[model samples]
Target: MWGGNDSTFLQGNTNPVSGQVYTMYHGTSMEAAKKIRKEGFRQSVAGMLGRGVYLSRDLEKARRYPLNLQAYQRVVLKVEVNVGRVKKIDKQGHPLQNIWHDHGYDTAWCPPKCGMVPSGLEEDCLCIYWLIHKSLSLAGVIICRQTKHLQGCMG
Candidate 1:
């Protein structure tokens, strides 16, 4: 999962959330995570309006959330430039891990974007958005945009 400087640390081990008061894991896999969730760790903060993860389910109330429109525009332009380098593809035809360099996630990480695509559904097409990302240039930004226009855009 993508995180930021302001992210809160958890009490769990391995994962940051493990060390937090809410998450507890006994095993190394999903079973262990589930066990921890079932056990329920002690969290000082309880249920409240827009208090939990992602700052409440209400977008309107969370008016303080930050955004960078200029950065967004830059990324979009970068995507337009690199959308043609897509070589390999996945089952749904979305770009898979680039064959050359996959270090952008490590070297030039960007906050993950979602909600446009349905859960479990592949915006195999939207890889262009990331593939063209300037931070993921060269081996990372390799997508063919001309061939796929608005294929991933929902609205």
Candidate 2:
């Protein structure tokens, strides 16, 4: 997850399925680094949800055995969802809406009339994270709650 691409990741880190892990220290501005890490975490969780299985991106030891893998996948999620937006509440645990509102339609199939979208900047956009997270959860896929702190998840 730390590496930018699959090749770099394979060169530096062991294959996760091999039940191995290594720590790599980094020296960077905390603020910037946190942003990158948060994004990576979300993407990683999305990968797991998409696969319908819980694979540890940070800890291979966690799924080293069949029993562990089974137990991990047993933890399912249950929540509501909208196609391209969240409920009245927001990811920050906010009580109301109209403040940070997400507006768009799902491009699941890149349907007609769904041309390129301009998501120019995360800081200037509403979020679709809660909707995605909730949908995944309702399907019995649980993502980390810690990801709510990510920049693109607050709305």
Candidate 3:
């Protein structure tokens, strides 16, 4: 996800994926470097959200049903974005997630009115981009919780 038309590349002491890691590289142009940075950051955010969602779904189900898989709540709720750490709560706080999912909009086609949009976006690119990112984050928290629980159970 980190390529552009510029001659510069993203070079630094810290790894782009991990805020704590470090690295160094050369970019072809300043523009290229910036683009790389942005793309890297975007990928990192996306990865985090994916991880969070995977955890949250399990944790949420467990929390709501209290280990009674047979009594698990069959909620038809639209997926929410799990942005950083997630709390074991019933409601999500993101407005975009609420509006898009609850209102029955095809998020992939959401538009921003911009002339050009990222791949997978047919309409509101910007809004959809942010919404997707946030939703992933929200889901990620649950994934984290689920993983932790699984680890505990296994240990």
Candidate 4:
């Protein structure tokens, strides 16, 4: 009962030997973004998916991060992730839930509405070193305030 029904679940890579590249979003404070832009991403000590850099493929989800911060104070970073050897943690208390990384998985994924996340949004935890490839450059920035539009870029 804990693993849930695989038949109704969306198709995903359950066991992968190689890595896959994906575009993901990471939301953080502008202050922290400055540091990340300099040093690079760091792995979290603990989380739903254990130790890794948490990200989401959903832009809206990324936009709502640092939950306590106002929209204007938050920075949504668009990142390209190289998730190597992914493990699907679709439900709570999964056998490999927290130790996927130790078992050779470079990334852990929780699909949207899988009942694992309270918000029902998809989430991913990737090993810090593999989270970014090449250079972390700012492509563009869009400020959405009610109706007005302002655009810019950092770095």
C-alpha RMSD for every candidate: 20.6, 18.5, 18.7, 9.0
Model 2, CA-based lDDT: 0.24
Q: Write the per-residue lDDT of candidate 2 for residues 65-128, one digit (tens) a residue.
A: 2233333222222122223431222123233323323233221111112221122101111134
The local distance difference test score of each candidate is 0.20, 0.24, 0.23, 0.68
**Which candidate's TM-score is highest?**
4
lDDT of 4 at 67: 88
What tens digits encode model 4's per-residue C-alpha lDDT throughout 1-155?
11222112223323322455555678888777778877778889999988888887776677777789877677777665556788888999999989998887788888878889898888888876555643233333323222237533232
- Per-residue alpha-carbon lDDT of model 1 for 22-124, expressed as tens digits? 1111112233224434542122132111111111111121121223222112111111111222222222322423321242221111111322222221111
Q: Which has the better lDDT: candidate 2, or candidate 4?
A: 4
Model 2 residue 82 lDDT score: 28
Clashes of each: 15, 0, 37, 0
Model 4 alpha-carbon miss at residue 20, Å: 2.1
Q: What stretches of model 3 exceed 4 Å from their correct place?
A: 1-97, 100-152
Model 3 gets an lDDT of 0.23
The better-scoring model by TM-score among 2 and 3 is: 2
The order of the candidates by lDDT, greatest first, is 4, 2, 3, 1
Instruction: Please estimate how well model 1 matches the true structure, expressed as its whole-model Cα lDDT.
Output: 0.20
